[model samples]
Target: MLQHWLLGSLALQNIGRRKARASLLIAAVAISSAIVFTGVVMMRSIETSMAVGFSRLGADLMVVPQNALTNITAALLTAEPTGEVLDADLLDQAHITGISRAAPQRVFRTEQSEFGGQGESVDLIGYDPGNDFTIQPWINERLGRPMQPGDVILGAARDVPLGSEIALFGKPFRVYAKLGRTGAGTHERGIFMPSAELLALVPAIREQTRKTPPMLEPRKVSGFLIELTPGATELQVRFALLSHLSGTKVVAGGSLLTGIRQGVTALLGGAISLVSMMFASTALMVSVLFSAIVTERRSELGLLKAIGAKRSQIVGMVLIEAIVATGGGGLCGVVFGMLLLRLFERSLVYYLTEIGVPFLWLDRMDTVLVAAACILGAGLIGAIGALTPAWRSSRHDPYDLIRGEG
Candidate 1:
């Protein structure tokens, strides 16, 4: 242990002597370590964000009419989907299944919305107040009260605040409450109302047909949301719903979360790999530079041998010098890497949130990993850099040094 300690101290001294070269080698390893750490965290954070986003569906088993899966997926993923009408009775049957709570929600759109600072076309969804709040805890009352007819909730609403009046079609809607930021959602840019009020916006189908080509079918409730009972497996419930409720899809809440995580992981992995490769190439360069330095120091090494330093001790000293240089560079790299990750998160928060993905701040585990990789990498580079020099010097004889004098 004492021998190793001496060797390490020597390494530090050598690195301190040539600070610039040491710094560059450390930079190479530190950068690589940071890339690995950032990639792992990004993959994890995005996956969690995606799962949360999918669960926003408000229903465990969405009982849309046949062929409406794409529409529902659209609403969940992009907040864009054409409206569909499905039988409302399906909600009751799902509830009676005794395995969970089922609530139905109706979705539609107003021809124009006052949400956009000015009137613009906007989508709207109406839900049963009692059950709706369970899934969307984020929908808590921020101002006037929980949702009611003509009461709409807004997202951060960009620069727009709550308490604004919105006009939808010919009806005046009040933005009585504002919703907490839910990353991104269909409702982020939409209005909410009682289904009855939304239905009132459209004339009776027969009445409309008389005037035009019956632009739309008589509107029915759009879908149902089911909450599984405790211990209920989401996958089992999903498939069970399919067996009973023909022509509808039961999307597993878990699967939705998994897909999002995997997608983000794939993206992050590719990017991180590319960045790591850059650092890796830098490390290779450091190795070559150090190797060349070791070669040039051969005479000095021979002189040390002539003074009676053992080959093992000489090798240990060379390694110590290389380690000090690399470790210092690595430590600096770690500090820079954290800053880079934070800067990246800040710059891409909006874009990541848009797709129900999040760029999480680096966590403790991430930091540990980054540091470990850098330290290990630095040690590796230094040791490898010293190998050839140590081997060459170990073979030197006192005769060679004496011969030089002759």
Candidate 2:
């Protein structure tokens, strides 16, 4: 134990003695590890974001009026307004072969002058809270209460305060809660209210628009959101719905996101490839750096050998030095990477949204695992880099090394 302690002390002293070179090695490892760590975390986040986004969308299939298919798709995916309506009774068709759940929804446009200093037109989604699976999970988690008649929930992008009142069709509705950010989807720019409330407001809406025809009808809705039973494929449910319901079009939600998923997958694949190349180059650089360090310390190693030190002891000492440098670098790299991710999270999300990609932060366990992998991989790389140099140095003839003859 004493001998091991002394050797460790000597290794640490050598690192201190060569501060400049040690710092360079440490910095190189840190930069490489940071890149790898960031890439891993971001890739995982993108994947999770896509999954959660799909879940939040709350449907395996959507049933819309035959002529309004494209318009409804645009409304749900891009937050555009749709003025189309379908028979509310169409929701009954969801009880077909493979369907698990279905909820009716009515979407329309409403303008509020009190929001953001100027009048802004926002998409309003009226849903059946009792039968809803989509958006309800988030609402339950965030608000812990069911939505009531005159209450509204704002999407993450809208600048609204909870408990504040906003007029819709000349009636005041209190803001219930604000949702967390979900980028570039209908939820980001939507305000959700009870379908019953929206139905009640139709008369008032007609009163306000005396010269124009009413857009909303008492017993009509815009679409039906559907979920499939376990072991049931979307294709099966969609086909069944199509055959059962006339004047309606059923679309698989997965088909809507296929293009976005392909783009994100390509981006993640390229990033991983780049990170792998960077790690390889970093390992090579570490090997070269340790080789030079071993050459410089030839005399010191020789003296240790002269004092009856075994070759294994000499290798252990070099291994310790390499671990100290690389481990420290890896830790710093993790911190740096996390800081960068946090600082640029919003900007990164915005840019990806513009490019039609989904971005989200990883869960705690995933983040920790990614960080641990980066640090451990870096340490292993450093140890491997020192192996050849340590072996070669330990095998040198003590007398020749002492005489500076090799």
Scored by lDDT, the top model is 2
TM-score of each: 0.46, 0.53
- Given candidate 1, what's the lDDT at residue 25? 64
Give Cα-based local distance difference scores for all models.
Answer: 0.58, 0.74
- Candidate 2 residue 73 Cα shift, in angstroms, is 4.2
Model 1 worst lDDT window (10 residues): 208-217
The TM-score measured for candidate 1 stands at 0.46
Candidate 2: what lDDT? 0.74
lDDT tens digits by residue: candidate 1, 189-302: 556555566656565322532431111223356666666654455666666777777666554344454344345546666776786676567567766776676666666667
Give stretches of model 1 more than 4 Å off.
Answer: 27-265, 342-359, 392-406
